[model samples]
Target: MAAVGGLADDRALLGRTSTAERVSDILRTRIAEGFFPPGTRLSEDSIGGALGVSRNTLREAFRLLTHERLLEHQLNRGVFVRVLTVEDVEDIYRARRLVECAVVRGLGAPPFALDGIAGAVADGLRAAAEKKWKGVSTANIHFHRELVALAGSARMDELMRTVFAELRLAFHVVDDPRGLHQPYLERNQRILDTLRKGDAAHAERLLADYLQDSLAGLLEVYRRRVGADG
Candidate 1:
């Protein structure tokens, strides 16, 4: 997990936004980055002191993330990252399949700037080679982010960011990271390859199938975890 303190590195954000907004942005980024995993308690004093903000400001920040469904407030226990259910995982993939596949299908041609998407795929390949499963997971997230960027809409990108952040909560619940992420590395390359060939229809089909398989596997894992707890 990345350091929570890394949030303070953005000097420009510090200079511009209100204290609560600034803290919320930092915490939101950390949560999206998987620095604070599901069920990890967030201490008011600790985060407030670290960010140099008041406890009141930190609580407001927490409220913002809670509204985003990234953090949940438990009475008496304080704030912790949200833990997603199997249904939540299915809904996330449902949205991803709709948006991401539509983006690919709607692309009428190629020779588009694909540097970011390709870079993300390469990053995932390298991380898998190094056996860094967590890095692979992060790179996979980046790959999807870049995939959505092909649509070229700021509003769509923002919506996908929120979706991806919520998806990360489900990912944190997986017991086998490799089992969750390794197979998709090559599939990502295949999608890019199909796109490069200008076969948008085929690429869309591949993406839909990919999401189906991923969602099925994730649901199984989530159900197993719940069963074990029972």
Candidate 2:
């Protein structure tokens, strides 16, 4: 079992608001940030003591994450970070295509509020220049997330948040971070440029193909890793 180290520092983040949901949020970010990699058994004692929260609260937080598919509890064993299978990888990409392409296709108007998307792209570019592949990966996630934010729908935002977190679980299996993420940086910019020109149709096409290509590449990496590990 691994200790979810530094959860104690999150006490400040909890601030005056102490709740299961807040605890879950902190754990979720840590998971997505790859601090708690997949298959890591979460220590109840370590986490509870670190956060200074009750066992019930920590259990509730674990339950929420389990429902999100970021964690799983084994009977008589313990809770562990969920490791995504190949099927899960394919399904996640399918969901991404369905949601993301639709979001691009249903554009309302030209010259949209693309600052968020643009900023994410810039973030990725900076990270790439600095040889921080992981940072680039994070920025890529933020790029799509900001794209979904354009819809102004809370439900959509929340849905993609869970999806993105699940996707990160699969990402942990890949060995070449730069090879996986660098190619998409330009595609993200291209999509942004297409949107800037108000050509939603072209942007949607680009995103659709992009998702398909990404899925294929990820499936290959996932299969290779799964086989080697087995």
Candidate 3:
């Protein structure tokens, strides 16, 4: 009987491994897909039960996501999806533009990783065409991230991960991602063209303007949502 009980426990543990992974995937998709909007309450008991996992395992998954900045935890009230303010958006874009534009200028054009950036842009265009807004957003983020990575600054890359995650939270507030992302497809191509031409200075200026315009549009939508929700 003891041996049977031990076997059952092992099966339960195995089941938990699967459940945690599924929970992570589900939460990521929901957040990215905007099903769980910013500031939405996340009940461990409810979500864990729904996903067929123990509370401990669910907590572990939540911790991982929180570290990624996709979720926030409040004492006593439990976890909630992160919400981005206008100020938050401004700060993120400021840091991103500063770091990324500097990276571009510093690269000085030495046969850097254009292929990776081009591939990401291509993937983003395809995702945009298919109306997969989340995928498009992620791909677009990756394109710029790789651009910064060209400078070989590990710290900048890490900073970008945090900024991008928060930016995704802001994106959840907006309704039309295609309207937001589609206009930039051509802009990205232009930036790539400049970079490929080894004109890093020109690329930096174009990237700055692009960041400004994009942030303005996003903030307008974000403010409107905050007003409506308030």
Most accurate candidate by TM-score = 2
Q: Write the per-residue lDDT of candidate 1 for residues 1-230, one digit (tens) a residue.
A: 36777776876565434788889999988876678988889999888888888777788888888988898988888899988866677788989999999998888777666889899999999999999998899999999999899999999999999899898888877889899999999999999898888888998999999999998887888888754331
The TM-score of candidate 3 is: 0.79
User: lDDT of all predictions, in order shown?
Assistant: 0.86, 0.90, 0.82
Q: RMSD (Cα, Å) of candidate 3? A: 5.9
Encode model 3's per-residue lDDT on 165-207: one tens digit a residue: 6788888777888888888888999999988888888999999
Model 2 lDDT tens row, 1-230: 13567687677646434588888999999998888998899999999899888888898899999999999998998999988888788889889998988888787778788999999999999999999999999999999999899888899999999999899998887899999999999999999998999998999999999999998888888888875232
lDDT value, candidate 3, whole model: 0.82
Better of 1 and 2 by TM-score: 2
Error of 3 at 215 (Å): 0.7
Q: What are the candidates' C-alpha RMSDs?
A: 7.9, 8.1, 5.9
**Model 3 spans with C-alpha error above 4 angstroms:** 1-30, 50-53, 228-230
Candidate 1, residue 131: lDDT: 96
Q: Report the C-alpha displacement of residue 178, candidate 2, in angstroms.
A: 0.7
Whole-model alpha-carbon lDDT for candidate 2: 0.90
lDDT score for residue 45 of model 3: 80
| Best-to-worst ranking by lDDT | 2, 1, 3
